[model samples]
Target: MKPSLQLKLSQHLTLTPQLQQSIRLLQLSTLELNQEIERFLLENPMLERDEPDGGEYASGPTPAAGSAQDGVNGSEQPSEQDNRDAAHEEQQGIDWSDTGSAPGASSTRDRDNDEEVDFQEFQPAETSLREHLDQQIALSQMCDRDRALARLVVEALDDDGYLHQTLEELLALVPAEHGVELEELEIALRQVQSLEPAGIAARSPQECLGLQLRAMPEDPVRKLALTIVEGHLELLAERNFARIKRLTGCDDDALRAAHALICSLDPHPGARHGSDDTRYVLPDVVVRKTRGRWTVGLNAEAMPRLRINQLYASILQQHRGQGGELPAQLQEARWLIKNVQQRFDTILRVAQAIVDQQRQFFDHGAVAMRPLTLREIADQLELHESTVSRVTTQKYMATPRGVFEFKYFFGSHVATDTGGAASSTAIRALIRQLVEAEDGKKPLSDAKIADLLGQQGIVVARRTIAKYRETMSIPPVSQRKTI
Candidate 1:
């Protein structure tokens, strides 16, 4: 075996660096792709940012967000909001578009060419839950000892304003030298609970609602609400009005009123004071109707305008093969530029294909969505299923309905009696419709929902319906029922 020296011809697939970059760029989300471009710009001296210009891709100076219908029409003219969003995205150092023009792009130059300059305005700081509570405690008319004890209690409370630690546990956190007692801590807890946001500083949700109920005026509904919150909260959550009546001896009208009152209380008071960081999604393509037909356009903001450095290019051209790595860098930069363009081109093609298949979804919402598969799209586009999968992974489409990931358009199918198939998305949408339109006194169960779908020629099992419902965060019939 060791002496064998016979040569055999073989062929295997190989991935070039350029091909690898193209594949990677295709799979990355718009944000990730932009980040990769920035890295390349830093690493490759030949690569540079291409300043957006009119007659090409017009980068508007405004930096404000726009609605789905911002640039839908045949007009390239951007609204004021669109211009602002485009400019803001550029300033944020995030390339959000791949289209030649940004989503909210406007003209690059000013008509007057006035020497007007832009100013950066400072946004006020957002206070955290602890900071908010501390401010309130500071302003309160409490003794230093009480204030310190209350501050300790506030520290023990979680972001949801619930005190998860028991009095003993909290007491242990206190130093033995502080001389803090259980009663003192209880008094401090009451002080914090009595602060603004009625349900704050409660040990449990029941106590939170009960505190709010206790603060309300002494009406029969308030009393009943408090009683229910403190004792029959589980029954109330289950929506078992019958059992509630059996236990509390209340009539339908009274229980309904009390239930309404209970619903008004906030379960998480501290959540209002919690830091709210809204993450805005930048769609890779914009879907809109033009002349009664749906069309997909790449987002220009998501596109990082890249170009080779002319100075370096000229020098390299004059001294070919002399700069050693410079020649390779230039070639690599060109590959990246071509690859980026190809990446977006591939993305646009896949997204358009998806829109074509899910046209019913765009026209009549999710309920009208038909069955779709990566195989169907791949076959139509003459691409591998894995390529289609990569294209749709982190890519997003901006439809008039809302911003949705490319993956949302793909789902399992349920067989129909007429030999047709319905998308799982559509089935879930149907379930939601059925549940929403159900009578409050008797909500639809999974079995009933399944039967309802069966009548519609869509064969979905009760368990499957339940699973879809759970995924949608919809409650069971027992929890959905009302008086």
Candidate 2:
């Protein structure tokens, strides 16, 4: 085949640099956006935080649209009432204050508790599992041999606090010159196991449970729990309560009590002190109920207050285009500022739209959630479906119910008999309710749950119910069965 030059007219789509930046900013989580802004702030001298009322800059980045949300440009000043109203309007949310209150006028209980110490004042947040174990070992009155051996075992422990290495392995780990033996290592292991969290230094899950059960005060339930963990743990896990009952010679009530007691024990006690990889979330918007109407606004705290640097602005105004790269930097800064503002505005608009649609969910919980799709929200907000998708991804909203990703409100639908639809989330909620209310003696199977939903005129297949159940981390009917 021969190739020839052709000049047929063709149409193409191109994204401008500013539009690309807007799209990029919209997709980033609050933390990631702040990081991007920090880079821009460092690279571009003309771009700086606009702090007002002598306040520090917001740690998050949602872009400050005005001079400062709270501060006026130059001429007019807002009244105290106006300032209060503006602050409220900017951070519209339920008056759901944090549970932590300022130490109020001391009550008798408060006065009595005043003498006690608090964790914050005593311990730092960065303390790790290894460090915590080391501290406990230091305070312990073990002999030198025991201490050294215990420290060695502590070092070998997994983050979940299990000593995966057996006594022989641990003994082999010791220095030949130290004269450490298997018996001493065993004693040292016991010493570590007896620490604050009841299940540390265990060789296996069975031992872990046994250790926790032994720590409890002497009681029949505790005795039964110890019996179960010591031998019938596999039986308990398989939900073979009938066999357990026959073997233990315990009635339903006694077995139930024992099961409940065993359930209360922490399987992985050391996990709480493991490497803290907690990801902090800064919600882009907060949904609130004001005057009996659901409302939403930008979370001011999550948005970085950005404004053109006055010094840079004045320099550019006077120097005009003469200041080589300064003009370009100023232009770049302006683009960033505009894009950031647009990013946040888009987030707020999308979040408000979501809150309006999912208001039933807020009032009556997940069961009342209606089926939603990206197209529905896009059409309602007059935005492209892709734009809505970008807005929802990684964006979050703080509501009275809880903080949830923007995407959580959107899900596929299931048809109902009334020629309507039900959200997968709502169906999941219904499934959860049925399971929770189900008799442990004969837990509802996936097929049974589907039939139950069908009875309510909402059609859900058994496999779909099973899928939803698995997603929710619920066990199957066999695993869920109890005495």
Candidate 3:
């Protein structure tokens, strides 16, 4: 064989600056995206938040396509030129409703307006549980060391107002403070528990319920209530109303009344104090199913409408003739603007491809999510596999079903008995349903679940079933056993 010169025509992907920018932007969380916008506004003299009554000068034709301001020192803006550019842009016309008038908007005018309202009006001062206890402790004339011990115990209480750790475990943390007798500590603990939210600072669910029941105004048949919470907690767990009547020495009528009272008691009194604050997840896409077709749209409201600064672009044009350092800065500015545009374009393309592929999922929910791979999507969109992965990584889409991370539509293929493949996500969902519907007295074990899956033609081992169950936070058969 002899070496011969050969010419081949093929396309390959290189990590271009534009692609890098797009990937970086695609993965930014909401907070990170806001920070990016702020950094851009600070560095670009031609970019400013449009202000109402700043007049026609405040917004300038929304800036032309490719215009972007060059930095003073490669990334810095010259103070004099920056001021002039900002003044010019301030005179530009814009519909205030477009950027302005949005709640929680980042604007100097908005900030100023917000500062005027008394914070106490709509926003109540939140008194944390620990702080509340501290206040009560401060008001008490307890000894210094006792106060310290009380604080430690209160801190140890979980979000549910139940102390998960044993008293001995807590004592170990502050052994030096063991000067206070365990009995005294117990007394202090009981006193703290008696404060507002009756069941708070309880050692267990039974104790929390008992505290609330003890706090109730009526005293008739109180002993029976206590007996039910203390001696017959198992009966309560199993919802054994008949057994509860026998155990509490109460007839059907009394048992019925006691059960109603028990339902009103707070099981996790401290949950509100240390519980998670409600977080709103805004989607990056909205998918709608109409006429048996799935439609997708980018959540435009969540995205910042960006454009190259026109005034800065003109200065860049002037700098090109002048030459020197200014020209370099102008080029840098152009690159930044181009990168921002490219980022949006790539994301839009990737998002559209995802919607097209997961149209079934959008129409019929996650169970209908077909087995999709990053390579397939990349090929469909004429992009590299890695590019597709990056674009889908942190991005999300909103569909008729709900908002889902773009990657949620993709999963590892589980080989089916019929030679076809199913999405692992779908299998996990099925496992969840099976476990939920399982008979409590005989909860399905991992092996039993695997057998069920086999019947569906999806061959998976017991360990694999266990792994999926663990991922769903379902406990093992022993732990799931009912009372």
Candidate 4:
């Protein structure tokens, strides 16, 4: 084969730098988008945020570079040298000495200082599970070698408080010179398990339950619970009350008490003392009702208020064609401002369309949520399906009832007896209601729930009911029944 040069006359879609930035910004969540904006502000000096108190950036036509002169109001506009002098003053510290005493300025500073102090005092410190366990170990009265071994065991425990490694495995981790043995590790393990959380270092679910049961007073019920945890844990999980009774010789009332007590114990004790990081969700759009009409608007707090730095931009325009990186930076700044505006516009439009389609949901909650899909919204808004999916990925809307992700409104349809379709969300909500209002003495089974839904014009299967019930963390009828 010989190498030859050939020209193909075919056109293909290509993503420019600006287009790629727009796509990346569109898919980011509110928090991520704000971080991206901050990065752009740092990298590009020509881009700066508008005043927080000022309204959002105007989505109308972007003014020409020559129109920057309109920003100066006085008859004698400031010259280039005056602008440079002002920029220099801003770069340096503000000269409060030259400004003398200004009215209302001291009051503003006092108010800001007071707010800063309050925020600093209320801020929380993050602490992890290992740190908490180490603190408790420090206060314990243990010898040096035992304390070191206990620290090793504490480090081996996972986030769920379960010790996945065996005693031999942990012993191998210690240096031989320390003369650590399996028996010493076992003692250290018990010492670490004796922390505030009753079952912090158990090896299995049964052992975890046993540890908690042992912590309680020796009563008939507690003894029965301990026996059940020691042996017959599988039968207990299967809700095989008859078999458990045969093995433990407990009556219905005693078995019920033991089962309740077991359920009350924490399965993952270490989770209670885990990381204390809090994530706050900020809705991208705010939906409200006005004069009996539903309306959707952008959340000002969540949206990034960005604008082209008029001073820098005007200066660059005056010195145009003096080849350097200034022209590229200015162009990049314009692209960012336009892209941010476009990203929010797309979000607002998609949110409005969702609210319009799922108006019943806003009016009557999840039960009234109809069957919707990305294709339907895309077709209605004349956008690509991928674009719609990107818009709904992490965007959230604050409705009258509560906040919900944009994708929550889209679900598969379930055929109904009335020749119409019902949303899977609505079906799940109905199942939850049926289970909540069920009789404890005779809990409704999956088949009965399916039949009830069938009578209500929704045809769902028993297995589907079971799946949704499990998804909602509702137990089986056997587990839900009472004496």
Candidate 5:
């Protein structure tokens, strides 16, 4: 084969540094963006908050042609009236009052005049969950290896205090400093269960309930409750009181007592500690209900005060006057500031896009949730689907329905009997509501519910209805049917 070389000219898109920073900031959750800002402040000497040079109103290129009101700038003067009006504007979904304010202060005068700015207080709790468990372990009589293994097991437990991971998996995760086998890990787990919360380290809901029942001081009803949890949880979940009564060979009074005992056990023992310890929700948007109408706004409170560093800008201005040479370092500093500003701009744009798409969710809650997808959002905003996905993933909005993940608005479409479509999420929500309100003595069958939904214009097949029902942990028709 003859070797040939050819040259052709073609254009391809390349991400500029500023564009890349914008994309990166757009993808970060609000908490993550705050952290990124903090890290940038620590590393960049040129970027900072400062008193405005003068109490003068200045004009620049306006915010990107957005739907928000056009006149607001970053440097508005702060006053009681300004605060009240700003709050009112925010509630009305108007753009923030964006006169040239110093990064931390609403205006230059406020920055120059005020010495103290009110900061959000971080109130620390008395004792953390891990600390509470450690204290219990310390007061116990377990040996060092046992304590070590128990610590691994306890740590392996999820926020609900259920050991979702297997003993083998936990054994693998534990360091060799513990030098424990799976059997030893299991044994240590059992000992951890002996702590104050009787079922803290159990592997499943049934197991947790069983452990709690076993720890009771030999009440006859406790044994019956343990029997139900250990072997008849499916029956109990379906509210099959008759089958449970028959199988346990308990009379009505005894079964009632046992059922009462079963009800007392915690389904989620560790839920009290809070679920998202790793990430906090700083809602990027807020939706309010005003006189039966829904109003939405970008949460200005959650946004950090950002402005061009006046001190650095002044220094750059002075250096410009010297007129000898523009330093390479100064150019780099300018690039950084531009990138940060672009980042915030992108975030604001993306936030607006999300609010626009999910406005219905804000108005009517989950039941009225409309179908949305990343591709749809991306197409609307002229951005990539991946960019939309990343923006929505960990982000949250404080809506009239309360705070929800931004991604919650997106759901798969399911065909309805009316030839229209509904979000699968909405159907699931409907099924949950139906199941919650079902009569325990005669629980609704999936097939019956499917028929009922069809009558209401949602055309779900019996099997499809069953699948969604089971996904929600609701059992089969046979399991749900009463005696």
Candidate 6:
């Protein structure tokens, strides 16, 4: 085949580094953005956080050079030489504030106040499951070999403290030359299981329950609980009270007591000692009802206040045209700042649009939520549907009804008798209400729930209702029915 160069005319879109950064920042959640800012602060010397009491320098638009007299204490206007310097600085990606305040120009008192405000008290670290087990093992009287084997077994156990691997599988892990006998491994397993949190090192759910049952005080109920765990687990799970009664020969009160005891046992005993790191969701935007109108605003605390490092910019200004890494770093810092600002601006716009569309939800809860879509918000905000999707993915809004993800407001529509569409979220809310108010002895079936919704104007299928019910972790009528 002969190769020939041909000029082909085509049109395509390309994202600049700044545009790519903007897209990335827009998609990131508040936590992720904060982490990204921290990373940039570390990598780029020309970027720094605008501290509070840095005055107007912390926020607002960069002032025009001609308006220098409007700054703090009527600062003197720059001369021709100073203007040249300022222009040079601007060219180097330095964004000077309108107030004309220099970077780190805040008084000592202001700096001290900022230090006090930014100080966060340290929290004590939580001990993990393995750490807790190791502490117990350390305190026990055991030889080196036994301790090592026990440590291996402890390490092999999963987060739930269940040994998913068989003894044979674990035995294979040991070196052949070590000649670790199965009896020694068994002893080690027993030693580890004998530690605190009664059900650790259990091979199965049955064994886990058995361990907890054995730890309980001796009682007739405990004995029956042991029997139930041993052989009648399936019957118990099915709530086949008749079969269980026939097999155990226990009366209503006795069986109930045994069941209650079994319920009290911890199926996952090691869960208590697991990692206790609680993740807190910070809303990116807040929606409020003001003077009979819905208003949306960004969460100030969630946003990282970023600014160009005036000190670095000044240094670059001093060495003009000495092209090196400084200019690249300066450009990068400028891009990051502009991208971050654009990200939040886009988020605020999208959030405001969402609040305006879903005002009914804020006023009357989830049931009042109207059917919304990404395309609707995207069209209203003049943004791409993918951009809207990214903005909604991890972003959250604090509303009168509570915090919710941006995506929570957008749901598929269900046709109604009134020729209007109701949000699937509204339908799910109605389902939840019906289930919550249902009589325990005769829980409402999915079909009954559908019928009730049909009567209320919203049309939904039984399968959809069941799916939403399961999504909300609600059980079926059969499982929900009380004795």
TM-score for all models, in order of appearance: 0.84, 0.80, 0.66, 0.83, 0.63, 0.78
Question: Hey, what RMSD does candidate 4 come out at?
Answer: 6.4
lDDT pick, better of 2 and 6:
2
- Runs in model 6 lying further than 4 Å from the true structure: 1-12, 55-125, 141-152, 165-188, 315-319, 323-332
Give the residue spans of candidate 5 off by over 4 A.
Answer: 1-8, 50-195, 199-211, 214-220, 226-243, 266-278, 289-293, 320-360, 375-387, 470-483
- Top candidate (TM-score): 1
lDDT of 6 by residue, 1-483 (tens): 899999999999998888888888888988999899899999988777866654532334433333332232335657998799778778888665675555655676587767788344556667778998999999999998999999999999888888988778889999999999999999999998888899899998999999888888898999998999898998888777778889988887888898888889888888887777788999988888889999998888887777666556666778888837778998898788778778888889999999889888888889999999999998888889999999999899998778899999999999999999999899889999999999976789999999999999988899999999999999878777654
Candidate with top lDDT is 4
Error of 3 at 326 (Å): 5.5
lDDT of 1 by residue, 1-483 (tens): 577678799999999999999999889988888889889988999887766652233222211223222222325767998789868887988764555554434345342333354332346678777788889999999999999989998898888999998888988988999898899988999999888778888988888999988888899999888889889999888777889999999999999999988888889988988878877789999999999889999988788877666667667778886988998998898898888888888999999999998888899999998888899999999999999999999889899999999999999888999999899999999999999999988889899999999999999999999999999999998888888
- What order do you get sorting by TM-score, best first? 1, 4, 2, 6, 3, 5
Q: Give the lDDT of residue 139 in candidate 2.
A: 94
Each model's lDDT: 0.85, 0.85, 0.71, 0.86, 0.70, 0.85
lDDT of 5 by residue, 1-483 (tens): 999999999999998876677677777777777788777667665444322442221222222322132222455558998798678766887544555543345666676545565443445655645667888998899888788877887787777788778877777776887566778976888888887677787778888898888888997888888888899999888777777877888987887788889889887767665544564567776766668655556666565544444445445566775633334434444555555455445555666666676666666666767677888878888978887777777777786567888677788888876678888778888888887788766778888788778887888888888888878797775665543
Root-mean-square deviation of each candidate, in angstroms? Answer: 11.1, 10.5, 10.2, 6.4, 12.1, 10.0
Worst 10 residues of 5 by lDDT: 54-63
lDDT of 1 at 57: 34
Off by over 4 Å in 3: 1-20, 46-121, 136-185, 203-213, 216-268, 275-279, 312-330, 436-443, 477-483
Q: List the residue pairs that clash in candidate 6.
A: none
Q: Please give, for residues 44-147, the per-residue lDDT of candidate 4 as tens digits.
A: 88777766654556433334554533343326768998799778767886776676633456888888878778675677765677888898899999988888
lDDT, candidate 2, equals 0.85
Which TM-score value belongs to model 2? 0.80
Q: What lDDT tens digits, residue by residue, belong to model 3 across residues 1-483? A: 998999999999798765566567766755567688688777766554433332332212344434343122234547997697556656774344676553334576667878897876877567778887789888888888778878888888766677777777776677674565567778778777877778988877888888888887766566677778888887766667666766566886676666667777878787666635777766666776667666666665555554445556567676667644545554444555555556556777877777788776665666666788999888988888987777777677776566778788888988998999888888888898888999876789999999998998989989999998899899888656442
Candidate 2 has its poorest 10 consecutive residues by lDDT at 96-105
